[model samples]
Target chain A: MVEITIISGKGGTGKTSLTAAFAHLASNHVICDLDVDAPDLHLILKPENEYLEEFFSGHEAIIDQNLCSSCGECLERCKYNAIKETPEGLMVDLLACEGCKVCVHFCPVGAIEFPMRRCGQWYLSKTRFGPLVHAQLFPGEENSGLLVSLLRKQARGMAEKENYNLILSDGAPGIGCPVISSLSGTDLAVAVTEPTPSGSHDLERVVNLCEHFKIPVGVIINKFDINLDQVKKIENFCQDHGLSLVGKLPYDHAFTEAMVQAKTITEYQSGDLAEEIGRIWARIEALAQLKKAA
Target chain B: MIIALASGKGGTGKTTVCASLVRIWDKPVQAVDLDVEEPNLALYLKPELSGRLISEMEIPVSDQEKCTACGACSEICQFKAITVLGEYLLTFPEMCHGCGGCLAVCPEGALSLGARELGEVLWGQAGEIDFLMGRLRVGEAMSPPLMRDVKKRLDSSRDVIIDAPPGTSCPAINAVKDADVIVLVTEPTPFGFYDLKLAREAFTPIGKPMGVVMNRTGFGDAGAYDYCRATGLPILLEIPYDRRVAEKYSQGEVIADALPEFRGRFIELAARIRELAAGDLKEVSNG
Candidate 1:
């Protein structure tokens, strides 16, 4: 199976909207939302969750007040500032806890108890396009990369078991841990970006990341008409780097309107924008196929 | 006082707002770009390089000669950064979280702290605005540490404006923490509205008052406005979608710099932010 991840180094460049539109075009594909922190694909796809699983990763120090020495050794030894000396006793701030287990190991009174922290939940859901594996990380929680890896693994497993040929993923913004986890082992990555300076800079960074991982990338310039001069610069950069400029989508209100309606651009309207997206998907497929043939 | 501009969704004009706010404010403001992964504040501000700070983290190195490979060090590692075999041990520096747990638990005193470069901080100046940006090393997973390093440049005497990274995760938290007030910049779309809620939930725990700036006012649905009104989040400013703004931003120009008309809006935003922050300060002093 081939996994094509749509990623933007910067956020709010229409990554999820484009992914949903592609989901409409690519039938029989397992969709995965790797943006566990703030997932929005479900808002568009409206997935009906079929299976839910609690994801437990990392650890948090739970102070046992009963063991109380009030010695404050754990508080002194904690580097994360997770242990706070309350009037009642030493309290652990789970949000600030890094799960380093330093307090648990060095507690002079052995008052610290370590437990596996439940960070978030992942789900296997059914959408109109196909089965989707997505997840949500609770507020003030870490381990985003771990959750993204879990979702991608589940998506790949479902794809193989169901004999689906494609696994399309929507990756989080920025070239951070979660984005790296999503990029791993993917066959092709579509870097959806805009024509702004930050957009061009971030696109190059994400493309460099893909290059570092030896993953082939295709560029999609969203809102390309917003700045044609910047578009020319992006085009030149793609040419210099030998990256494929797979698509250039114009600025359209339909994308946001479609999102408000909880529908993909292809599903919400039948116009030039939809037609352009269709052509963009065709180019991405052709590029992926070309890589396979080579 | 320190104010932060953030949006859970990227490209919602956090950097633009930060640059514009710094330009319009008459005081010497510290414009900190805490989006270490892909910092763009320097791009807009055109800062002149003044200083640099290198941030490093400690990774564990095992001493084979002094050791009985009891696997104690590996056992205590939460990140699985170290693996101990019967005769040997291996360390993955990239996987290390620099927690120093393994060094503490080494029974034979065989594990020692070794330094690894996490990232660096660049401090510069754009006219009167002090610009500080953290840059994470490419392929590095850790960013919060670098963010903390960048924040070391915080001069409390000067007004500070932090441009936080997108997403309501540890990185974003690290950037916006300790700010007196936070300004959430977002467009009026379903995605924006949803992520704005997430951002609110994440920062609400910081116990700081926040307001919203609806960017691209005419571009999307009014979901963001509804969310702000329902949550009682003050609308600090609304920047309508204009091709000129987009064009100027594409050319690495700050909005207030390119369009003098937007300076009044930014000035008003700064005043409102100060007004809100003063109330928070009063409550802090009272309590």
Candidate 2:
């Protein structure tokens, strides 16, 4: 099977749109959205829920106030500053707690209880395109990287069970935890970026991260016509770094218009932009094939 | 007052709004780039960095000599960063959360503290603005620690504008949690509106007054506006979808610097934020 993950270091650079378009064009594939915290692909794909599972990871400390001796040992030993002496007596701030279990171990009275935190939920769903695996991490929750990994594993299992040949995933923004987990084992990491300076800078960082993980990378400059000069600079950088310049898409408003209707650009219209996306997908498929052969 | 410009989605103009606000503010203010993973505020602000410090976190390291194969350290570690095999102990520093639980649990006193490089904290000046930012080390999974490092330089005496990372997750929360007020910059689209609701839900518990700045106003629908009205998140500013602004932003030019008209709008935005913050504070005092 060939696995390709679409990622952009900077947010709002059309990763989900392009991934959805690719999913529409590709056959015998499973789609996955790894942007758990702020997922947008579901809005476009409109997946129908098939199975839902709660994701529990890590632990949070809860003080049993009734059994507490009020010794303040948990507060002093807690490095995260999560335990606070509030008006209702000592309390644990759920947001601040790192779930290290230090309080539970160090409490002389054993008043601290460490319980698994329900971080979020993952879903298996069916879209018009194919099977999809997605997740939603609770707001302000951590462990997004772990959640991404879990989704990717589920996607792989789905693809293998159905004998599918491809797995297309939309990754989170930034060169951080979730992005890392999404791109690590993929066959090709497609870095979708814009011609702007922020996009260029972030693309470089994310590409560097892909290189660190030894994953092959292909660059796609969306909205290339916005600034021709910036596009040229990005092209030169790609050449110098020996990265593949997969494709360049012009500035288009159909992306937003189609999104307004909850449709992928390809499904919304058969215009030049959709055609260009098809061509880009062709190029990415060629690269994926090449990687597989090697 | 500390004003944080954040978004539920990436590339929603958090840095753009932050850079412009710092330019039009009438007084010397601190501009902090809390998006350490992909910091872009310095690109627009052009800060001449005056100081740099390496940000590091402590992880436990074990000495083999005094180590008994007891599994207390591994048992207490919630992150599974450390594992004790039959005769050897393995440590994965990247997975470590630096909570020091392993060290505290080791009865043989074989574990010691070792510093792991997180990133770099830089402080400088962008004309009259005091600039500070953090750059996370490449491949580093954690960001909240580095964000905390950058926030250590926050000059509370001066007005602060924080450019927060996008999303409604832990890193975004860590950046804006302490701000007196938050300006959620979002485009007017389905994706933008959906994530805006999530961001609002995430940040509401912080109890800080927040408003919305509608960007790319001409395009997309009114979902964001309707949601804002229903939730009482005042619409603070509406930057139209102008090609000139896009071009200037593409070139890394601050909108307030390149366009005369935007300077007035940004100045007005700063004023409106101040009034909102003051009003919230007054209500808090009365309550």
Candidate 3:
């Protein structure tokens, strides 16, 4: 099975919208939302969660006053400063906990419990489109990378069982851990961007990241009409780097309108933008199976 | 004075504002571009390096001839970057977070710390600004260390401005954590509003005070305003959608050159940030 990941170096460049539309176009594909930190794909796919799983990550050290020896050892041992002294005894602020188990190893009376931290939840759900894998990290949780890996594994398993041919993932913005995890096994990555200065700038960053992994990459310039000059610069850049300048989509209010209604532009209008996305998805599929698709 | 150009979301003119700030500074301002994971400040600045490029960390390389393929290295890795399956061993240096947990656990004297170039930290000057940027090596998993290296160049007397990477992830956290004050840059859009909330979550954990600068303001999304009201984060400046601004940035012009009025605004931004950094907001919030 081929995997195509849609990533933007910068966020809010409509990466998820494009991914959702491409998912619609790519039949027999298992869709996964790897942006576990602030996943908004659920806002659009509206996946009907079929199965849910609680992801228990390793723990932040919490002190028990009952077994407490106030030697002030735990307070100094915590590198995250998670342990704090209270009027009665010691307390642990769960959010600040790094789960490094520093205090647990050094606790004199074994007062510190290095229990698993309740970070987030992962889900296997059925969307109108197909089998969707998603996850939600609690507001203050820190294990987004783990959640992403779990979701990706679940999606891969589902795709294999269902005899699907593709795993289309929407990666979180930036060159962070989650993005790295999403790109780990991607066959092709389409870097969605705009014609603005930061857009072109951030596009190069994401493109560089894809290049690092030797992942075949394509560039999609969203709202290319906003600035033709910048578009030219970006096109020239893609050509120079041997990256396929797949398509240059124009600025359209239909995107925002679609988002408000939780619909992909491909679903709402089925017009030029949709047609363009269709072509791009086809190219992506071709790029993934470079020899076979050709 | 420290000027931080941070938008809630990516592609919302954070680097545009930083490029503008650097152009107008006209004096020697130490510009530390801390967006290490995908730093683009160098692209806009086009600055030549007057500094050395050095790798940030030394990864532990296993000498296959020296020892057995014991499972000790795999067991101690908090990152799980190393694993041994049967007679085969898999090592993903990209997954290594540089904790040295594996090296400490290795037996048979098999592991030796070898220089694996993960990324580079360099210092360069752009216009009147002494610029520093951290470029994470391709396939390198860790970025925080490179960002910290760039941040180590800060001179208290220099007018410092940081171009932070987008999102509230580890790289963003590493970029903005040590800033005296964080100036969140956002657009007046629903998407920007949503991600700005994510950025807010990142900032509150550090207990650092932050303000906002609204870019491309003509769009009728008042989510940024609503967010400001709810969180008490003041809106410092708003740059409306201007075609000239786009042209200047496209041609690698400083944002301040296209809109000269922003010089005072940024200078004032510096002052306001210092005031906020003087424990003003912390006192107010905790009071």
Count the clashes in each prediction. Answer: 1, 1, 3
User: Candidate 2's residue-wise lDDT over A1-294, tens digit each?
Assistant: 999999999998888989999999999999999999899999999999999999998889999989888889888888777888988789999998999998899998889888899999999999999999999999999989899999999999988988999999998889998999999878999999998889999999999999899999999999888899999999999999889999998878898999999999999999888888899999999999999999
DockQ of 2: 0.84
**Ranking according to TM-score, highest score first:** 2, 1, 3
Q: What lDDT is reached at residue A46 by model 3?
A: 83
The sequence of per-residue lDDT tens digits that candidate 2 reaches over residues B11-97 is 888888999999999987999999999999999999999999999999998898998879999999988899999989989998899
CA-based DockQ, model 3: 0.25
When 1 and 3 are scored with TM-score, the better candidate is 1
Fnat values, one per model, are 0.77, 0.90, 0.23
Interface DockQ of each model:
0.70, 0.84, 0.25
lDDT of each: 0.87, 0.91, 0.75
User: B1-287, model 1: which lDDT tens digit per residue?
Assistant: 89999997787889899999999988878989999999999889989998987898889988889778788878888888998888888899998988888887887888888988988889978888888899988889999878777887898989999999888888888888889899999888888899899999999989998988888877778777878878878888888888788778888999997999988989988888888887742221100
When just chain B is superposed on the true chain B, each candidate scores a TM-score of 0.95, 0.96, 0.87
Candidate with best lDDT = 2
Per-model RMSD to reference: 2.9, 2.5, 4.7
Once model 3 is optimally superposed onto the true structure by TM-score, how far is the C-alpha of residue A286 displaced, in angstroms?
4.7
Tell me the interface RMSD of every candidate, in Å: 1.3, 0.8, 3.5
- Candidate 1, CAPRI quality class derived from DockQ: medium
